[model samples]
Target chain A: MLIVGGGVVGASIAYGLAEEGAKIGILDAEDSDFSASRGNFGMISISNKGFNNLAYFRLSYASSRLWPEFASTLREQTGIDPAFDLKGKVYISVGDREFAAHAEKVAEYARRVGAEYQHDILNRADLRQMLGNVRLGERVTGGSFSPLDGIAEPLKLYSGLLNAIQRHGGSILRDHRVGRIQHQRGIFTVEGPWGSLSAPRLVIAAGLGTPDLASQVGISVKVRPQRGQMMVTERVEQSFPYPVSGLLRQNPEGTIMIGVSTEEVGYDDRTTVSVLRSLAMKAIERLPDLGSVQITRCWAALRPRTEDGYPVYQESHERPGAFVITCHSGITLAALHKRLLPQWILGGRKDALLEPFGLGRLQSASAA
Target chain B: MRPPHDLPEPPHQVSFRFGDEEIEAWEGETVATALLASGVMITGVRAMSGRSRGPYCLIGVCHECLVEIDGLANQRACITTVRQNMKVCRQTRLRPLTGEDETREQ
Candidate 1:
C-alpha cells in the first residue's frame, strides 16, 4: 500500500492500515509546502461542518465519535498526547434570533439524518461563569454544543501519527514530493525525485497535490486552496474550557486562540494587519478581558478545500484501486482515516454513499 | 456554549517568549505573565506603521505581540508558547530596505 502526503490525514490512515496488519508506505513532502496539519486549528469541528451537505455531517460525526479512543490509542502506542478535549464546542451567536435559526438548522438536519443533536442557550451572566477569565458582551448570546465535537493540537496529532505509523511498520518518506502517479494494468506507480514506488493499490492524501497526481490518470479534482489565518496567544491558563465554534479553540495551554478566516487568496498564505486586527477585536468584543492578553503567534495555512469546502473521497474510474481523499478538515477527519478508511483501502467494501463527496460534485454544483 | 465566550476552565499547555527570554505556562496563564516572567518587553521593530505593539491579549486573539519565529515571519508572540527552544526574531522594523533590490541600477 502506498500513501502520499504524510500529514495527519495520511499518517492516521497509514497508521490505521499498518496497525491492522497491512504494509504501508508514505511519501511525505518538502518543508516549504503549506501543511494544514502544521498550521491547522485542530478542532474536531462538527457544529456546521457540512451545513449544506448531510454526508459531510455524518462523516464528521463518525470521526468525532472515534476521536477519544483513537487519540488514546495513539497516545498509548506513541506516548504522544494530542490533548483530546471534549468539554464541548460553543458557537457564539449575534442574537437569540440567530441562535434559534442555527439551532433550527441543526435540529432540522439532525432529524433529516436521524442523528441526535445536543445544545443549550446562555445569557451574559451564564456565559461569564463558563469562561473563567472571559468578559462577555451584552449582545452576545450562548451557543450550541455537540458531545461528538472537540479539538486537539493538529501538529501534535500529525507528528504522533507519523511516529506511530512508522513504529507500526509503515515507511514514511519525508521531504519527498511526489511528481507523478502512473497506473498500468493492475500496478500503480508513484514517481518522485527521491525514488519511485509501484503498488497494486495507491492512495493519494496530498492536500493540494492530489489533483496533479489524479490527473496523471484520467481522474480530475476540483480541489482548490482556501487559506485561513489564525492568531495564537501567549498561554493563559485554561482560556476556555471547551473550544468555541467558528474556529476558536483554547489549547490546553493558557491562551485564547482566535482565528481561521477562510479566503480564496490563491495560495498566498500571508497574514495582513486588517484581517488580523479585525479577528482579534471581534473575539475581544465577546471576551473583552482578552484585550490585555498578549498575542504570541499569527500565521496562515492553505486549507485543502474542495469547491464546496468539504471532503472528497474518490476512486478513479480509469484506474481501479486508485483513490484520492482530500479535505480541509484533515484534523477532524483524522479519526475516520484511522479507524474506517483502512477497509476501503484494502479492497474491502467501498461505501458508495461517499461518492457524493467526490470532485464530481464540484462540477455538478458549478453547472447548477 | 451559546455565546462561546462562556466556558469554565479547560486544561492545556504552551510556551511564551519575549525576545530571547521564555517561560512555561498553563492552560489558563495569559501571555502577559509568560513575557513579564521572562523580562522580554522591548522591541527593535518600531512599528513603521501602526502603534507600537507588545504583549496584549495573551489569548491569541490580538496581534500586538506578533513576532517572527523560525523562517515563517509575523507570528503572534503572545498566542504561541515557547516550544523546543523556538528561534524567535522580532518583526521587521523599518530600517530602509537594504537588500540587493534597494540598489536598483539601470
Candidate 2:
C-alpha cells in the first residue's frame, strides 16, 4: 500500500495499515508544505458539527468515542501520550439571543440523532463551577456542555503516528512532492521529485494537494484552501480543566491557544493585524482576565475544505483501488482513519457508514 | 565559559531601563541580547495565559522577544537596537492600535 501526504490523515491511515501487518509506504511533501495538521487548534470536538448532515456527525462521534483507546494504543506502542482529553467541552454564548440559538441548535441536533447525542445546557453560574479560577466576561450568559468533545496535542499525535508507523516497518519518504499518478492494469505508479514508485493500491490523503492528485485519477475532489489564523499566548498556570470551544482554552502545557478566523484568502498564509486584533478582542470578551496576558506567537494555516465543509472520502470509479480522503477536521477524525478506514481500504468492503461521504454525493447535489 | 577579562571589550557601552531597572548594553547588541546578558530571561507575560516567556530563538523569527519601547507596544526586541537611555517595558497584553496610532504611523 502507498499513501501520499504524510500529515495526520495519511499518517493515521499508514499507521493502521502497518498495524495490520501490511507493507505501507508514505510519501510526504517537503517541510515547506502548508500543513494543517501542524497548525490545527487540536480539538477532538464533536459539538456544533453536522447541523444538517447526520452522517458527518456520526463519523465524528464514532471517532471521538474511539479516541481513548486510540491514545492508549499509541502510548503503548510509541511511548508518547497524544494528550487526548475528553473531560468535557463548553461552547459559550455571550448574549441571550446567541444562547437561545445555541440551545435550539443542540436540541435539534439531539432530536435528529436521537439518543446518540449527549450535551447539557449550563448557565453562567454552572459554567463558573466547571471553569475554576478562570473568570468569564460579564456578557457570557450561558453555554452548552458536551462530554463527548475534548482536545489533544495535534503535533504529538502526528509524531506518535509517525513513530508507530516506522516501528511497524512502514517506509516514509520525505520531501517527495507527488506530481503525477498513473493507474494502469491494477497497478498504480506515482511520480514525484524524489522518484517513481508503484503499488497495488494508492491512497491520496494530501490536505490541499488532494484535488490535483485526485483529478489525475478521475476523482473530482472539490477541496479548496480556507485559511485560518491562530495565535498563542505565553505559558501560564493551568486554568481550565476542560477544553472550551469557540473561545480560548489553555493547553496542558499552560499556553492558551486562541484562534481561528475563517477567511477565503486564496493560498495566502500571512497573518493580518486586523484579523488578529478581532480574535484577541473576542478572546478577551470571553475571558476578562486574559486582557493582561501577552500574545507570544501568531500564524496562519490553510485548511482543506470541501464545498459543504464536510469530508470527501471516495474511491475512483475510473480507476479502482485509488482512494482520496480529505477533510478539514483532520485532528478529530484521526481515530476513524486509524481504526475503521483501513478495513474499508484493505478488505474492499462497501461500508454503509461511508456511503454518504463519497464524491458522488457532491456530484449529484451539483447536478440537482 | 569565556571569562570577561579574556573577551575583547565592547566598542561602546549603552545604558537602558527595563521596567524601572537600569541596565548596561553593548552598542551593537539588540535589546534581547542585552536582556539575556543581564540574566533577564522572562521578557514578557502572555495576555491570555498570564504566563512568563523568554527569548526562544535569539533570532527575530520567533517574535518571543516582544517588548514595549518608549510606550510603543509590540516592538520586536531581537531586531531593535539598544540605545542609551532606551526605555524598555515588557508587554503584558496586546493593545489594540487605534485610528490615531495608525495616522501617526502614516
Candidate 3:
C-alpha cells in the first residue's frame, strides 16, 4: 500500500495497514509543508461534533471510546506516552444567551444520540464547582460537560504513530510531496522531485494537498484550508478538571494551551495580531486569572475541511484500487482510522457506518 | 589591542537573596548569571520530570532559567537584572493545582 501524506490521517491508516502485515510506504511532505496534524489542539472531542449527521456522531463517539486502548497500545509499542487523558471536556458560555443556546444544543444531541450520549448541562454554580481550582470570570453563565471528550498530546501522538508504523515494518518516505499522481495498468505511481514510488494500491491521505492528487486518481475532493490560530501561556501550576472547548486547558507540564479560531482565509497559515488579541481577550473573559499569564508562543495552522465541514472517505470510481481519505478531526478519528479502515481497505467488509461519509452524498446533494 | 588602562571599570556589586542565602553579583548581571557566579548551580527542578535544570542558553530563550522573582512565578531569571535585596527562589516543585492545600489529579 502506498499512502500519500504522512500527517496523522495517513500515519494512522499506514500504522494500521502495516500492523496487518501489509507492505506500506508513506510519502510525507517536507517540513515546510502546512500540516494540521502538527498544529491541532489534540482534543479527542466527542461533543458538538456530528450534530447534523448521526453517523459522524457515532463514529466520533466510538473513536473517543477506543482512545484508551489505542494510547496504551502505542505506549507499549514505543514507550512514548501520547498523554491521552479522558477527564472529560466542557464548552463554556459567557452570557445567558450563549448558555441557553448551549443548553438547547445539548438537549438536541441527547434527543438524537439517545441514551449513550453522556452530557451534563451545568449551571453557573455547577460550572464553578466543576472548575473549583480555577477562577471563573464574572460573565461565565454555564456550560456543558461531556465525559466522552478528552485530550492527547498531538505532537506526541504523531510521533508515537510514526514510531509505531516503523516498529510494525512500515516505511515512511519524508520530504516527498506528490507532484504527479498516475494510475495505469492496474498500478498507481506517485512522482516527486526525489523519485517515484509505485504500488498496486494507493491511499491519498494528504491533508490540504489531497485535492490535486485525489483528482489525478479520478476522485473529486473539494478540500479547503480553514485557519486556526492558537497560543500557549507560560507554565503555571494551575490545572483544570476538564479541557474547555476552544478555550484553554492546562497541560500536565503546567503550560495552559489555548486556542482555536476558525477562519476561511484561503491557504495563509500565518498568525495575526488581531486573531491573537481576540483569542487572548476571549480566554481572559472566561478565566480571569489568565489575564496575568504571559503568552509563551502563538501559531496558526490550516485545517483541510470539506465544503460541508465533514469527513470524506471514498475510493475512486475510475480507479478502483485508489482511495482518498480526508478529515479535519484526524486526532479524534485516529483510533477508528487505525482500527477499522484497514479492514475495508484489505477487501474485507465495508462497514456500513462509513457509507454516509463517501462522496456519494456530495454528488447526490450537488445533483439535487 | 587596547591597553588595560583604557578598559572600563567593572560595575559595582549588588546583592540578592536566593532562598535562605545571600548572593552577590555585578550590578548589571542577571539573576541567572549571578546565581551561577555564586556557585548555585542546578537552579531549579522541572515540575513534570523532576530533572535538574539551570540556565542553558543564558539568552532567555531556553526557559530553563525560570525562577520565582519576588512573588511572581515562572520569571525568566536570565532576563531579569539582579537588584539589591531582590528575593529569588528556585522553582523546586509546582504549586498545588488549586490553592494552598488541594492538588488536582492528572
Candidates 1 onward: DockQ, in order: 0.02, 0.08, 0.32
Once fitted onto the true fold, the runs of candidate 1 whose alpha carbons sit more than 4 angstroms away are A95-115, A352-355, A359-368, B1-106
Mark the regions of model 2 whose C-alpha exceeds 4 Å error after superposition: A364-368, B1-106
* Candidate 2: chain B TM-score against the reference chain B: 0.84
Q: Which stretches in model 3 have alpha-carbon errors above 4 Å?
A: A364-368, B1-6, B95-106
TM value for model 1? 0.74
lDDT ranking, high to low: 3, 2, 1
Query: CA lDDT, every prediction?
Result: 0.71, 0.84, 0.86
lDDT of 2 by residue, A195-245 (tens): 899999999999999888988888876777888998987555666677678
What local lDDT score does residue A176 receive in model 3, on the 0 to 100 scale?
86
In terms of lDDT, model 2 sits at 0.84
Clashes of each: 57, 4, 0
Q: What value does the lDDT take at residue B22 in candidate 2? A: 94
lDDT of 3: 0.86
lDDT by residue (tens digit), candidate 1, A217-249: 666777788878889865444456667777467
Q: Cα deviation of B84 in candidate 3 (Å)?
A: 2.0
Q: Candidate 3, residue B97: CA error in Å?
A: 8.1
lDDT of 1 by residue, B1-106 (tens): 0112345744445555445555555544444445555566743253434455677666656556666655344456665544644566666542111121222221
Q: Model 2 Cα displacement at A275 (Å)? A: 1.5
Per-model interface RMSD values are 16.7, 9.9, 7.3
